[model samples]
Target: MRIDLTNIPSEGKSLHFTLTPDWWKSDLDEDRLMGLEAPLSASIKLYPAGKKIAVEGSLSTRLVMRCDRCLEPYGWDLSTDFRIYLSIAPFKGELDVELSEDDLSLDFIDGEFLDPAQIIREQIILSVPMKTLCRKDCKGLCPVCGCNLNMTRCSCSSTYETSLYQNS
Candidate 1:
């Protein structure tokens, strides 16, 4: 959803919306590893701070993620809060400029509108864990037979030797 900058009153604006799984499927990339199990509830408040706009929001939802260890899909609950400051892009011409420490923290908007969907999408992606696991004690798959060890025991022996260099 796009919010017009000019429409925001001096008193500020507050918005509440629900983002659906279908919206995520369409907005996210095709290789997205996770899916939304339920609709996400988001609330955002926008305030004009000097020449910049400040946005504060919170979201909660259930996500369907794949386990890295067992390669199984599992549900996870997610709740997060975020804050960002947006300003109009200062550089219009094609010129290389060095960025400072303060420049790295703020978000730049292109036109006179701000897209909250983009912010939510970025937050959701950043919230995901690097290593996903269905359970801590997952046995994973057997190397020899490619069988899921968590489901059933395999006949493959676990005593496999390893060497840095093999004589060929």
Candidate 2:
């Protein structure tokens, strides 16, 4: 989503974007985000100041996730509110900033325009979970018998303990 600076108010800019499920359904190498869908609506808030803009917004959508226990594919809703700073450059080396946060990285743009789509894609990727599970009590498939204990209910819960030397 590209916001024209002329449309922004002097005080602040507020935009309401209707992001459909198809927006996330792109041909990009979304393998990491495969099966993730964004069939929902979201809003973005813009605060523009001196060739720079601060963005904050929230979005909720269904995304693909793997079951942490059984390693199965599952779809679920993910909600996240992100804040970022964007800048449009009129000339090269025109933007600079001093570090204040413990871990803050700056990305400089040499273009005269700003595209929020790139930032949105980055935020979506960062928002994904490293590990997902259908439930906390999920019992994965048996290692030897190859049976999902959560569904099979076998009495093979006993396994070798590698921490036997820790107590000694």
Candidate 3:
């Protein structure tokens, strides 16, 4: 997973690898909201740009995502391309320096080693949707009975007053 910068040839270096669900399970935290339904295919190309390294890659996989509304597991196909610039030199500027638009795409590295696994992991995590839903009209779970409304109707009263703005 770690590539030595010095080993990269003058022209460039290309890497291809398959990341399994087990890899993600071990890398991700205990509260991970997503799972890999299939092995992820990754392709990366590294180019040396003076003191900086340019990484371009693509990832494709099937992910098992939990729907936020229904709390059900659903399959989602993922395919995305990414480009990252790595600066080998550490910035010596002031800590309070403002970042420009170009600086947003740049990453700083301490040593000559690059961990592609970490980059792939980050890309996968960033691809997760903020609001996950299995369907557009998910009924969700009943507040009182905790029953999935999408499956069956609960006998609990549906009319409930909002207590959030109530004067206490």
Pick by lDDT: which candidate is best?
A: 3
Candidate 3 local Cα displacement, residue 39, angstroms: 0.5
- Model 3, position 55, has a per-residue lDDT of 82
Quote each prediction's TM-score.
0.77, 0.64, 0.77
- Steric clash pairs (candidate 2): 68-132
Write out the backbone clash pairs for model 1: none
Per-residue lDDT for 66-154 in model 3, tens only? 87766888888999998876655455421121222332322323256677877777777677787777777667776677787889987
Error of 3 at 146 (Å): 0.9
- Between candidates 2 and 3, the lDDT winner: 3
lDDT of 2 by residue, 1-168 (tens): 555643467677666655665566443533445555556556677677666677777776787766755666667787788877665545662444332343333432323333555445556666767756666666666655666666775555446111322322
Instruction: Assess candidate 1 and give its lDDT.
Output: 0.69
- What residue runs in model 3 are displaced by over 4 Å at the alpha carbon? 26-32, 90-110, 160-168
**Model 3 poorest 10 in a row by lDDT:** 93-102
RMSD of each: 6.1, 5.5, 5.9
